[model samples]
Target: MAKKVALLQGNEACAHGALYAGCSFFGGYPITPSTEVAEVLSGELPKIGGKFIQMEDEIGAMASVIGASLTGAKALTATSGPGVSLKQELIGYACIAETPCVIINVMRGGPSTGMPTGPGQSDVMQAMWGTHGDHAAIALVPASCQEIFSETVRAFNLAEKYRMPVQVLYDEIVGHMREPVEFPEPGELEVIDRTAPSVGPEAYKPYDTSFGDVPPLAAFGSGYKYHVTGLNKAEDGFPTTKADLVDAEERRQISKVKNPTALADIESNEEYLTEDAEVIIWAYGSTARSSRYAVNELRKEGIKAGLFRPITLWPFPEKRTAELAKQAKAIVVPEMNLGQMILEVERVAMGACKIAGVHRVDGEPINPGQIIAQVKEVL
Candidate 1:
């Protein structure tokens, strides 16, 4: 049978993708470039018997998601830059408690309401370090409307599989632009739910690492009652002040996604003609679209230019990037902000390649000409 397809804005695709992933609850406060996600879900969730709530603020919205997720609801929330800032404290709570919830952050200009309707990739670093702690982070950056749909689904899977908060961020240009999205049939795309504890309520601990670093998460009121807290916890779920236990717990949480095995599954990127290229364009989100155009133009002129787009921003794609840095003589990074992701590219390149950046934070999208010019100068 032919797949059902539609012209969808990135935000609408995200809403439908969440539904496809069996998301049962959405708790969010409306914010520019992302409000459509809430609007679409508002009318659709009830028809499917799912719950949708608009909280008084971003913090409340995020808090509601973590709370509902505790009850095993495949919960999600949507917001932009400012809202994300407000949600950071609770995001930290979700991380430490090991809650599985998805956050859709439509990228807009920032530093406190910089540009509600403009595109910005400045939040790239915030997604990893915004919560203020030594915890693991999984952030997906999709460059198109169709990818936003599929990556939203992938975001939920990673959140559940890793038993933590996962973020999906796309620029406002991608979020509001319309494109055709082919919907995946039932069972076509992989859907992962949090593992359930096999042990009965009599023998369940929320942070039981004996089952592995990522232990099964039992839903609240599902015949399993376990303590959930923001404080450092032992395997039994109670707060631990012991230095050894605290140190071990912290290490375990970060190692869950930082280790080589975990990084292999969490890191994703795209390489276009990078094998023989002398200059590589490193971009993500909407800036990648322009970089692709620049690469083609440069190739037509007989220049060795390629594009390396990072789909999973966090986990950094360090190893592959280091390889690219060695293979290419120069790396050009174009982003919607003043050198946000360029920092990551530079750190990984470690002076192995000539690195340059094309930055724009003045409420404007970075164009192909800008990327092309930067690539030329770096070469």
Candidate 2:
């Protein structure tokens, strides 16, 4: 039997991926480069008997997602940079409250509505640090429309499994670009939901560690009433300022994603012809597509070149990156922004190899020719 496929835009793929992942609630306002995601869901969610709400603004959208997710619904929201800035506070709230939700941030030029049409990867760091306080973040960056759909599904899985917010960030190029996408059958792709508590309502706790680091979360109206707060909290989900309890809880939250065993399941990357390459291109999102092209071009010229693309952005893929830094003589990082992800590569490289960046922020993408030139210049 042949599977049905469609020439779908990246945003469209994301919407279908959410449905495939069992997302029943969508709370988002329309924003450029990402509007299609909400537009598609607004129509499709109702058809599937799910809920879709166009909130007043980005903040309200984020708030609604948190509320919906607490009721045991797989919730999601999509926005660009400006909208993301507005949702930062609520993003932090979701963090402290330990809710599971997915946020799709399509990167575009700007600090504040800079260039809506011009794609940018400047939001990479913000995805990790936009929210206040000390908390762990899981963010994914995919280069193509197919990856956008697949990674969006994975983003939901990570959020539900870890009991935290997980984000999928891509540039306007990939978000608006059209590509052939094969829809996964109902059971083709894995869908993960938050762990449910086995205990009766009388003994349920939102952040119970007795069930292990990630406690089972019971639905809000499931006859289980538990406190959730922005302030530091104890295991019972109530506020706690006690030094030992606060320290333990905070550490546990961050460690859940940072722990070696946990990180193995969270961090993802792709390396191309890196075994004997002297120059490696370290890039993500749309820039990585160009980098991959440059690697092929450089290899043709007898320069051993390869690409190391990060699929999971948050945990930073530190270990694998460090290994590549040591193996390669130099690494070239070209991004839509001045130089955001390059900073992380340098930190992990720590003088292991020479690193340089090719940056452009004029609402244009860095071309493969430019990446190849940088590789030669470094060589």
Candidate 3:
């Protein structure tokens, strides 16, 4: 039998999820709608023999996570809109150094603290392209409390597997709302550890591309002393001024995630009302929750409407959207942002179907009725 517990808020579940994901280090600064995540983790991490630090600001927090990750620890941090902005540069540094770290951004209204406590899905594109330069990124959006936990673990796995930074993008509603969650047994899931080189210290190169661009990582005090920096460098960890070496390093950094088949781990619930009908509705995150209810209601009214949701926000899952678009006559994209995700949807749709973007940025979710109306209009 499944255990039934009281509803758990998304932030609490996120902290618990990080704990379950074997996170031993947390460095963060508190901000609205996301503070609970840092608070819960702070209390629980120490009890489980983990370390938690409340840094002076978000930049220090991000730097601390990268440092902890290089030491071979599964590390994480949680913050909100403005804090996320502060960490972008260090985020790029982590990308260059190939640090395995998880960043949870419980998003509120953005463009610099636009609304501290209000809900918003405005961080979609920023979470994907916020860091400077070209680098591989994976952003997972959780629509409910259950995903808060699952996605946090997924963030860790991806970070470690790719040896890169992964973001679990959360909206204020999902971060603060309460819902039931059942955690699975620990051993049932596969955990990917960082690849450590077995070569002798004298023969090892920390950034050797031959090892699938992932060299065995040596810790700071592991006796195989090496240098790590944000600058372009060679496999031996020395800074290089060569253009070819710079291009090679940048490409290698991106290819690790781009080349991996796990890039498009999309989760969507679609109805085939459109298999015979004319219109499709696309939405995600909190808005998708409401859009789902609306789609069902539309079906009840004999309207042929279906839904498309993206679990993996980054990488955009363009292929799936393209496939769905090819089969439909019209498409509706509802998002909390002012067309941020919708732009991607349109790009992926490839103009195969008639498409329009429905968006809201008034610190509220794009409700169900609005989506149904949009679907009807498109039809």
Worst 10 residues of 3 by lDDT: 263-272
What are the lDDT figures for the candidates, one per model?
A: 0.92, 0.93, 0.83
Taking all chains together, the TM-score of candidate 2 against the true structure is 0.99
For residues 238-356, could you state the per-residue lDDT of candidate 3 as single tens digits? 89989898988888787666663655432324343556656778777788788788888999998878877677777677677888889888888887788887788788888899998
Using all chains and alpha carbons, the TM-scores for the candidates as numbered come to 0.99, 0.99, 0.95
lDDT of 2 at 293: 90
Runs in model 2 lying further than 4 Å from the true structure: none
Clashing pairs in 1: none
For model 1, how does the per-residue alpha-carbon lDDT over 147-233 read when each residue is reduced to its tens digit? Answer: 999999999999999999999999899999999999998998999998999899999888888898899999987788888889998
lDDT of 1: 0.92
